[model samples]
Structures are given as structure tokens and as C-alpha cells.
Target: MRPLDPDDPRSVETAGRAYRVLARIGSGGMGVVYLGRSAGGRAVAIKMVHPEFAADPEFRDRFAREAGLARTVGGGFTAAVIDADPEAEIPWLVTEYLPSVSVRDAVHSSGPLAADAVWDLAAGIAEALVSIHGEGVVHRDLNPANVLLTADGPRVIDFGIARAIEASSVSRPGARAGAAGFMSPEQAAGDAVGTAGDVFSFGSTLVFAATGREPFGEGPWHVRMRRVQSEAPDLDGVEGDLRALIESCMERDPERRPTAAELAERLTGRAGASAEGAGAAGEGGMASLPPAVTAEIARRRTAAENPPVPRPRLEPPAPLAPLPSSPQPWPAGPGRYAPHSTMDPAQARRPRTPLIAAAAFVALLITIGIPGGLWFTVRDTGGGVEAAPSAGPTPTASAAPASPSPTGIRGELTFTIEGSGRVSSLTYMFNGKTTKLTKVRLPWEKTLQIPSWPPRIPWKLSYTCPPGGSSDSVAVDGNVIIRGQGSSGTNMRSEGVL
Candidate 1:
């Protein structure tokens, strides 16, 4: 991973700090997170306040307060804030980077986990919520992205949108668009949020994981809003303990939903009983048992292999071996004696001597011609060639008609210039060196074709427009360079010169 670009609006700069940024891990409304490493090689997730919010001093102060509150609720299911600098240019806070997949990605890629995994996820989230609520913080945004599925359990992330119940106001300008399908009715209505909102969001997330669908309507923002505010969440496909638990969490009345502690206990009890039943079943089936996961293998093999869908841990096998190197001679009659056929060293040396001498004579002549060859080349160019010795430089070879000699090449290039501007010529440059084009013509609107060219080299194309307007981009073979002027100006050009 490379360190996030400091100039990138999504990247946070903590220069002179002990840690070095590795790469951007994720971003949310409040800030972007970077996976970074300390001088001591410890992996940490660094979140810097979005510059838009950092401009507001009040938001920074609130972030600092919330960060302190977040630090207090460290436990099994929450990412604990390790360090923070709320006063930096891009106020950044660091946390532990638990190597895990987000709930959204897990469900989307693998479809969904089994019932056991879902139960574990629900219990972990409930326990984490209890700690968060105990510390006077309410996670206003608890969507699938914030819920991470790790080996230990699910861990909740992103508390920038969280509210402290003690504060008089938690809402900021457009605060957070708390996930559409997960927001509680109060949150959707822009009313005050309580612990129940977190529970509701968590339940909605679980429902999404179970069914691979949102609990509310999809499409435009207005439609989703209508569903969140008025429609009852459909828990039709939800089964097991999840059905009852989700129902309680998503109850319209906040008072009717169970507390975080209560939900955690219920889910934990279900998990324990399920584990006991699984173990008992295993014991009872011992007499008629098959190999571990053997039935699963048979079931999968019986189905069609969907090629378009990537199957991890699987690749086509290697090809067969080639034919033998040489043909074997037929066996002689009963091992009859034969004359010795091995060649003497002197005989082998005699044949190679003349060839070696001829090669030496040729090499000597080539060595002698080196200086003469250089002089001829310089003389042909009028001795105007200069050798500054740089990475790349434009060739000043004299223009000539296209020939099969491979000295220079010319071809038609269609330029698709997007912009409301007039293009003069498409100039080609090698590396950072500029090429002086002698002739130019527009083959099409925003397209240019040049003739009598030079040999193809690693190069890029730049476009020039009237009134000194220029387009930025360099492409190989100058096939597709878009050029244009104005904010929405786009131009596609093709140039062939080598």
C-alpha cells in the first residue's frame, strides 16, 4: 500500500507525525480513513476530519469530545480510538485497523453467511452498542459499511456521526445522511435520537445481511425517504431467532424495542443452544457419518460451474508434457560387438578451427568500421546533432516519405476532441522533451493527422487551442487523447508519429 496523497481532498496530512500513511482504507461523510504504520511498525487506521467540516471550529470541538467518549467504550466489538489530534490542519484520529471485510462487501460478494455467522454478528453488535450507549454516545449511522466482520466477531466503526446524549444539539449542517434503510423513524424524521436508533440501525443491517436486500424501498432519494418514514419493514425471509429479534428492534415505537443489554443476552443464549445442538447432532451422527464437508462437495459438483462468476481457490490445471527430445536408435541383434564410434578430440578441434578464424576476422572488421560508421552518420546530418544525454529527447531526423526501411512512420489518427474550442495542432513529445512538428492538418473536428513523420518512440500527445488554450494529457501512440476547453471541455485526438 502506498501512502495516501496529501493533496487528495480525501487524504489526511499529518506531516512530522510519528506515523506514515500507507493507503486510504475508506471514507465517510465526516472524514477519510488511511491505513498507516507507526515508526515502530504498528498498523493504525488514521481518520482526518473532512476539510469541509474542519473549517467549522464547533465541529472540530465536537469531534474531539466524541473521540474522548469513544475511547471510553473500548470492548470486543468496537474499534477503540488509540490516539488523536483534533487541532491539526486536517484533524486526524488514529484507531486499530482490524483486518476484516465490511458487512456490505461480505454479503455482496459471498451472498450471505450461514445462520451461525449471522447470530455471531448480531450478538457482537448488540454487545458493542451496550458499551457505546453506556458511555453516553449514540451511533447515529450504523449501516453495513460501518459493521465489519472479523474472525472474532463484528466490530462497529465510524463514530464521527455519533451523538452525545449530554449535548444540547448533535445535528450539524446536513450532519450525516445516516444510511437510508437503516435509520430509525426518529432519525428519518430529523427528530432527536436515542439508544434505540442504534438498535434499529443494527437490526436493519442484520436484515440486509440475511436477505441480501434493504428493508426499505430502492431508487431515488424521495422514494427511499417515503419508505423509511411510512412503510413497515418486511422481515418475510428472516428466520431463526433473527426474525423475532429484528421485529423487536424495528418496532415503530422506540419504547417497545429491547435494550442493547437485553438483545445481547437473547442472541447469546440462542447461540449457546445452537452450538449445543450442533455438537449433539454431531455425536448422534457418528455411526453413519461421512467425511467432513463431503456432502457439500458432492452438492457443489452436481451443479453447473458458472464461468462468469469468479470461483476463488480454483484454477484450470497445467497442460500435458511435450514430445521426446530425440528418437532412440533400434536395438542391435543380441548386443553384437561394434566398432568404437567416439570422435577423437583432435578431429573435433580441426573442424571448429576454420569457423572460429572466420568469425574472428569478421569481428575485427566490424570493430574497425565503428568510428567510420559514426562519422558517416554525423556527416549526413550536417554535423548539427548535439548530444546533451537526457532521459528522452525529440528526434531531429530529416522528414522523408513513408518507407519500409523502418526509419519513420506516418498513419491516420482520428481525434475525438470534446470541448467547445478550436484545436490548431496535436504535438507529440517523448518523455518531457518537446518535438518540433513541421506540418499539421486537422483530419476531423478536434482530430489531426500528421505526415512525413519519424520512427515510433515512447511518446505522449498534447493539444493546442486558440487563444493559448491547451489540453493536458499524454498517450501512447497518440491514439485517444481528449482535448477541450472550459470546465466541461473534453477532446479525443489520435496522432501517429514515430
Candidate 2:
């Protein structure tokens, strides 16, 4: 038997049979998906509903209806339902696992699909929607993320929020179900949704696949919603028949939009023609996909077959050592330099016989006589005093200034980025404010002067590099030195006091 994934707890089981959860494949508002193997050793994608939602009868009913609808949607483009248990403590459903990457990831990693590949993708998704709508189910959520690109073709997998066309509400009040940029205008406006809403979402998804951006433009949720409801979709880079088809699908009035079956017919160039021979023709048309698309599909398949190894857990760091103590001042004495008059009473009352006698002897020697300007020097050695002859002129004793030294403290904040790509941007956050640094060349070093304050002033530094690279915030205090290493996609960081 294959070993259970240590990273995922094995507390969950479906229908009294244990499924070794290999890893968490995806998650969304409704539930979490896990990559697992059945008792019979079949790979499956298991979606378990959130515990909080399982307690609500309304949500449970909706979940059961979604599973029933999904079971009815049978096609080559849809993942078949393997097993499900909606009445369980945490209702769960399982489907055949497809080793593929989502359309969003494919476009993000390899840029937009070529024109021909976009056509193939559109055809596949439209066909899936046909099978889905035939079962009287509306896939309320159909964004690029829900469409998986596989070697054979694309598959529409996540039906968590799918509801029957006759259902009272798409979702509970105050809760929006679909993605922002792809939701239909009617759906965004909280109006009754229908199969046409999915068609609108399909058109938006195609726009993203063709241009590597959202059709309605990206921003805050309200802005995207406003654009979807009022503004024309930004389809600048889209071209040709596909563009026209997308425009037709995005009609402002739901009644004017064509059905999913009609879209599939149009995409496969079989409009107004018999349904026979359409599948063969569609297959033949997609057989000649662009080399880039083929390579990306192959790459995705390989990745799915061999998912990345989980990183090891890091141990807690050791505690820091304490700082050293400051030095203390020395005691006072008498001679030419007598004890300060402000000395403590206890110390001042102590006898000064030896010191007084020495002072008197020096005074007698100076007064009783000596020739040629004799010189004498007295030094305090902690235990007693010592006298020595001076070779040069005797130095005069001067009083120390009654103030601390006049020195200013300053420091430098140095950032050394050792990546291969050029730095695109850098910013530092301190004292509730953020400061952006000028872009610098690769393998760069820059320094900013910092005025002295407290010994430790907390700071957070962030950096970004060209061609998609970013460093996690490097947090430190006082004078900081940051070192960043690695190429565009994989960067590491280190910090030290300057």
C-alpha cells in the first residue's frame, strides 16, 4: 500500500472506508479538495464541505442537489462522480482524478493560448456546458480556475455551487456565489440567474484564455462588478470569429444570448447543420494545436503525475545571548587632587593621615628649598601613590568639563540583492509609513543613511524583481543589512545588523 501523506491528517474517512489523502489539491468557499486513493487503489479528488456549513439544513440540501446534478452530467469533458455521502457529519463527494492544470495556471505560466488553442478550449468548455445544462443544472461558477487543461482536452470540475435552474436562490442573501470578473451582469446584480448566466461566464473565461487577463478588468470586487454590469468588456487583444462569438455570448439581455449548445455548434463550425459528424470534425480541428499549447499541456500532465515534494518542517530558532554590562566609575583620593567636597559623608569621615603626610612632605620640600626647578610627579595606583622625576616640563592639572561628550550617532541601511534579474521595486515600512526605493540593477547594493534613535527600530523591507519574482518581507531593527539571493521565481532572504 502507498504511504499516507504525513502533511495531511488522516482523521477524515468517507462512507466508513479509509482514503489515504495524499495532499490538498484545492480549496474554495464551499469546501476543501484532497488528492486521495480509494480502498481499491483508484485515484480520486475528494471534496468535503466545511463543518460550519454541514450543520445548516439549507446548505446540506443544496449540497445534496449539487451532487445529484453532477451525477447526471455525463460527458467526456466532465469528471465523473465516483462516490458521495451528503448526510455524513461533513458531507463529501469524490470524482475521478484528472491529472491536469487549471486554465488560469496554464495561461499564467505560459502566457495566453494561441488562437487555435483558444478555439479548442472554447469548444470543449461549451460542450461541457451543454451536457451540464441538459441535466437542468447551471454551473453558477465558471471561471478560468474551474477549467482544467489536460493532455486529452479541458475538463470542467468544480460544481460546488452549481444549482438547479428552478432553485429559489443562487445563494443565501448577502452572499455572492460566482467569481467577480466572470459573473454575468444579472448574477452580479442579485437578479434571478439562469443558464444564460453561465454562457456569459463562459465568454468571459474565453477572454481570459485569449488575452491572459479578465474580460471585465481587475480591481476591487465592487469595481469589477460595476464593470460587468455597466461597462463593455475589455477584449482588446481578442480577434476574429472567436471574438464575435464571445461578444454575442456577452449580450446585456440574457434573452438575446445563444444557448450553450448553440455556442458549441458555432465554435465547431457546425451552425445550422446536423449534429452528426460534429464530434469527429471537432476532434480533427483540435488535432493541430499550436506547439506552445501542446508543450504546456505536456508540462502540466507531468507535474500532475509527480506533484512537488512537501517541504520539511523547520525547528524553532535558539534564543539570543544577553548583552554585556557597562563599566563603573573609580573612587576618589587626596593630594594636589583632594577628594571632592561633595563626597558621601561616610567616605569623607574616613582618616586621611597617610595622604595628608605625603602632601605636607611635598609642600615642605617645595618651600624649604631646591635648586634649578626640581620636578615631582604623583600618580594614584588604586592601592597608594608613587612619585617620579619628569624629563620635560611639568604638566599642569586641568579640571574636566562638566558635561558629556558632544557626539552624534548615525548608521547605514544596506540592501544587497544578489539575484540574476534586475530589481523592479523595493519598499520599506517603518513607523507606520512606507518608503519606496528606486529600482536598481541586478547584483546590486544600495545604502540609505539612518538617523540615530532607539537602539532597535523595527523595520520591514520588501522587494520585487523582473519577470515575476518577489521576496518575503525581511523584518529587522536598528541599522539593517539585507541579502537576497536566487533567480526570478525562487528568492531567499537573510538579515543582519549593520
Q: What TM-score does candidate 1 get on C-alpha atoms?
A: 0.53
* Tens digit per residue, CA lDDT, model 1, 144-188: 878875434567887544442112122222323456567898877
lDDT of 1 at 289: 13
Candidate 1 wrongly placed segments (more than 4 Å): 1-3, 6-17, 160-176, 272-498
Predicted structure with the largest TM-score when compared to the true one? 2
Per-residue accuracy of model 2 over 386-461 as CA lDDT, tens digit each: 4444465643322222222223333344444443556666666553456776766655544454433322234455
Q: Candidate 2: TM-score? A: 0.56
Error of 2 at 353 (Å): 50
lDDT of each: 0.55, 0.62
Estimate the Cα RMSD of every predicted model relative to the unseen true structure.
Answer: 19.2, 20.9
- Model 2 error, position 370 (Å): 76
In lDDT terms, how accurate is model 1? 0.55
